[model samples]
Target: MIDQDHKLGVKEANLVSRKLQLSGIQGQEAEALVAEIEQQFGVDRVAYDPDAGTLAFSYDATHCNLDLVESILSKRGAGFATNWWNRTKRSYYRYVDQNIKDNAGYEPHCCNKVPRK
Candidate 1:
């Protein structure tokens, strides 16, 4: 299968999907937040489920991270679930996002590609 290019700043190889239980906001407010997030660079897509109270999104980790989204949530009076599982996932997401961002500029060279001296 071939991987096609996604939105701006979003590469298929770097795409990540995340779903988080949300709190403190819903209905039109949640939709508004989703719209705001969707407008950000590197964000492939965003959706908020009112019934499940969860926000699911796809983004390119190398160009965008969870921190940027979280700031918007905080400012808009939304928050993640306080359960242990969600907390753990949040921490892991942060770690992976930072890792991707840190390595985004790195170019790997194969040993076989080196020219003979």
Candidate 2:
């Protein structure tokens, strides 16, 4: 009778608890391990959607000031040429250095003057 709603089944939970008990871990220490495992696997920014059967993810592109994220969002926006969410097929798109420089259509807002690091 292993309950599966808690991510881990009852048998697995019992095994893990037994192992922790054998290791002399009690109270907060044992609880901390369980919490850590849950957090590690649980989706924060990246995950797979079971209903959609698609991979969902997010990225912060500040490192290179890349425009891939912006482009994707723009394409997904209303009145755009493409609707990424409605597509049934998986598609891959990437930003290249050349595309950033040559594409006049992809003008990003610039501050003109950069502050000292």
The positional error of residue 51 in candidate 1, measured at the CA in angstroms, is 1.1
| C-alpha lDDT of residue 40 in model 2 | 35
Sliding window of 10 residues with minimal summed lDDT for model 1: 1-10
lDDT of 1 at 42: 90
User: What are the TM-scores, per candidate, against the unseen true structure?
Assistant: 0.87, 0.21
Model 2 compared with the native: what TM-score? 0.21
Across residues 49-94, which tens digit of lDDT does each residue of candidate 1 receive?
8889889999999878898999999999988889998999999998
The prediction achieving the highest lDDT against the true structure is: 1
State each candidate's clash count.
0, 0
Would you list the C-alpha lDDT of every candidate in the order shown?
Answer: 0.88, 0.29
Q: Give every collision pair in model 2.
A: none
